[model samples]
Target: MRFNKSIISISYMLLFFQISISILGTNNYIVSIPYLKYYFDIIVLFATISCILSFFSQTIAVKELVFIVLWLVVSAITLVTTKDILVVTNALMIISARKFSIKKTVQTVFFANLFSLTTTLILFILGFVSDNNNGTVNKHSFGLSHPNQLGAVLMVLILCSAYLFIHASKNIKFILVILNIFYLLLLNSSGSRGAILASLLMFFVLILFYTKPNYLYSICLLIGVFFFCFSLYSTSTSVYASGSILNKLDTVLTNRVRMNNVFMTNYGIKIFGQQVLYTGGSSIMYHADYAYLDNGYLRNLINFGISYSLLFYIYLISVIRKVNSLNLYSAYIIIIPMLVYGFVEEGFTSFLTNIVLLFTSILFISNEKERE
Candidate 1:
């Protein structure tokens, strides 16, 4: 598997920017450097151009083009209805996924995330990033907008780290293990219950699939559904209001669940997605102006509506199936957790989600050739 240097370089650069832009576009930084957020748009543009160049160099699958068109339609709808151009970033990543094999893309993302996490840790140690205290808990934001965001990032890193650990060289394995531990600690510190559980479940499922492939695959699938529901319930405040095991774990989730209900009640299920007229709601803490739908699936419904979002989900699952066919269990380790955590996290709507999607898509197509 000869590596394309240009693709690797651009992919890593794009990923670094995708992960770091949240911190870079922080309120303080935005105030300090007006319009700094727009710089991320330039990064997206560069990534898109790189993908276009790769298209001529590499043979593209019909399936890749189909997904790309679907993503662009999504971006177009988002632009038309919400006037949000950020969807282009997501669209570009879908296209960019064709540039590398699954292994290369996974390794690159693993390293990029490691770099981002390490940078966050250094900044926290240097007092550049605040260690936030939220009444009941002391959480590390690591320069992101919120502790949950940090947890979300750590969740992806944990899965990637686990994959790397399984495949790393003897010398590299120890470091990967150490990084995994660090990621777990940060995830716990961030108090993202959904991500924590999702990561654990992903690792467990992967282990079962690897070790007991014949007996456990069906059982693991059943357990995955149960675990996913339990995780969602654990993260939702309304599900266990009686100060039960759920509340004992975390009360903030009650607020999040309530906010989710509010959106569902207010917006209802629309075939063509409705504009979110109001962003203010009970679950919002830092951003009092906008309502926070903590669930990514629900958020997708709001942004792209039922019909289009369902199309997106179908495309995503097809890619996941492709990865599974290639036996790239690590990509599953990264994506499955993200999908579960997306129930309670908002990464699906952002560039970070698309980055994962990009890699998974590329892995799907690239690995197909290996089979051939």
Candidate 2:
């Protein structure tokens, strides 16, 4: 069988992001990707060049440039004061990597699910040996404790939704949809409320992206679910996501309180360069969730200051609108989940998380003009 160029292109794209992330993600505690903190600029610079080449060659969308500019501005502000610039680089790299089509989009989704499942299985075994003592559900895959990984799950789910809405499929598509849902459930049982919330938000996103009559669409979704569940087997991990859907929902909101306080504080809202002077939380840091922060908006203002924090939000919202205007509902699917979850979790403020979000946003923007 002949391989399609779009498949080849997307494979290359996912490879690029995956490699960069693996090389950088760590638990050293000083900051996940310190290299990203200082030198990720070089990668972004290269990504800028790549996006331009794709645009000129008509291989990607011109709206890609909008993201590049937004990233550059936020990155510059973040670096000038905080001297950290990973998000900028990741954002550009993300933009240049993904320009989704059916085949590659599906591949992207499969690979993401595969990776997530593999990781979950490994952890599950580890938990079994430790008699489930080493890690607990509430703290593991879902919260600020693992935002980066949780963010990845959300990205893949968004990509899957993008594929579903973009193209009409047959019985196989329905099966694939069911599988994705169960796979998502298995991943969630590993215990992450953020992931759960993110998935639900995307369900509605599909509705928003499609401009046609949505009532009739319900039949299509039911078909997809049937196909999805039909493939279940005995070895299939039967562990229901351990707790209530309302399970850790309160813990999520309580943490939001301190985050809110972060924003509510005057120091949190200062413009760029002001962070250099406000050394309050710099010396003191812990897990955003295990710690406590109620106000999401206020958290950024205090932690990174008003300018850097606000720029981050602006970058996110602007990219969403850009994708929506282009009518790439899948990209919208990706962002909506994160937006809803952002209210209860503080990962939105982490340099690592923000960078990941930035990069994913760019991919959707570039994919706006991607063909069927």
Candidate 3:
């Protein structure tokens, strides 16, 4: 495939803009820009249409056509039901970049996030951004909307850097140490146990992958399946019941299990997504009530509907199989952590935060020999 410099540059800029806007939107100190979301929606719509045109311009096979049609149907349903354009936009961006290498896609997302995170932290240190701790001394938002947001952003950056470093023939040990140390600091400062645990698990899995590659697949699969099932169980069960194990677990997870149960019981699951009014901890100042379902599995089922959530899980599992078949250990290692993180956070639902979703383009392409 011949490289088109103009197309590549345009796609890169579009991805950077999309990711930057998404990250900046999470910062608490930034004054809400009037009509900014509308502008974003416009750009995303234009970009998706342009990408679809570019994608169809090439000679596509029957298999590709079938997949594309199915994806479009799901995307349309998701957009109409959930009103989430970003999910569709992320997939379209990946489709648009099919002609390019996956490495380029990862690099684009990594740098964009790094830039946003650095800027936010700088402003925070300069006292230009307000640090919201939810009236607690132990937890810090670090300029983002919540303490967990900082941890989530850092986790994304760490995974991206780890993948890049592993593929670039760098000192993996040193990179792992540095990344884990940074994660520990963030954990201590922000009290984001979910992100810290996810990072630690990723680190351990990577080490095992290097030392015992033969058993790594089964281990990862088991961990992912366990988390997925646990998330479902917690969401379905009545976590507030006295003497229930889920109730104890809910306390350990800072009430995430109970919140999931509340939302699931109230809204229930649907085949197509529904509009959910999520009043998170950050909204406490504005509203008397607060409920946030941090579990990604439940969030997807409730927000995007049962069908969309199932499709996403199927896609994720297929990606894992492809990674194993292609011996893409680095990608597999990174994906496992994202899956585990989803058990406690909703970041897995968005491509801007979850790089694994972007890999769908590479894994689904006709040529299976392409290396990242």
Best by TM-score: 3
Runs of candidate 1 with Cα error greater than 4 angstroms are 1-8, 27-31, 214-252, 277-290, 351-355, 360-372
Candidate 2: which stretches are off by over 4 Å? 1-16, 19-70, 94-110, 119-155, 158-168, 207-252, 262-266, 273-289, 292-300, 304-315, 322-324, 346-372
lDDT of 3 at 310: 76
The TM-score ranking, best first, is 3, 1, 2
Model 3 local distance difference test score: 0.73
What TM-score, over all chains together, does every model reach? 0.80, 0.57, 0.88
lDDT of 1 by residue, 1-372 (tens): 234556556665666666566444542221255677576676666667766755654566777677677777777776677555656666676667666555656666666666666776676677666655443566756665567667777777777777666767998888877877877887888877777878787677678657864543344344435644554354344544666665444355545555555566566656656577555343353333346676776776765577666766665666665555666555556666666676667676565643456664444454544422
- lDDT for each residue of candidate 2 in 1-372, tens digit (9 for 90 to 100): 123444436434644454344323321232243564533444455455644443433444466566556656766676677554544444444454444343444455445445543554454455521112114444344221243354445445444544554564677577657766665655455454555666665666566556542332343334323422321111122211234322233344433333333323324345653442222142244323244442234445544555655566665555555554554445444445555445544554442232324334343534533533
lDDT string for model 3 (164-233, tens) is 7776645765765576576568656877777777777777877877788667678778877998888878
Q: Which stretches of candidate 3 lie over 4 Å from their true place?
A: 1-6, 30-32, 35-50, 53-58, 169-180, 281-288, 365-372
353: Cα error in model 3, Å: 1.2
lDDT of each: 0.62, 0.45, 0.73
> Residue 185 error for model 3, in Å?
1.7
Best by lDDT: 3
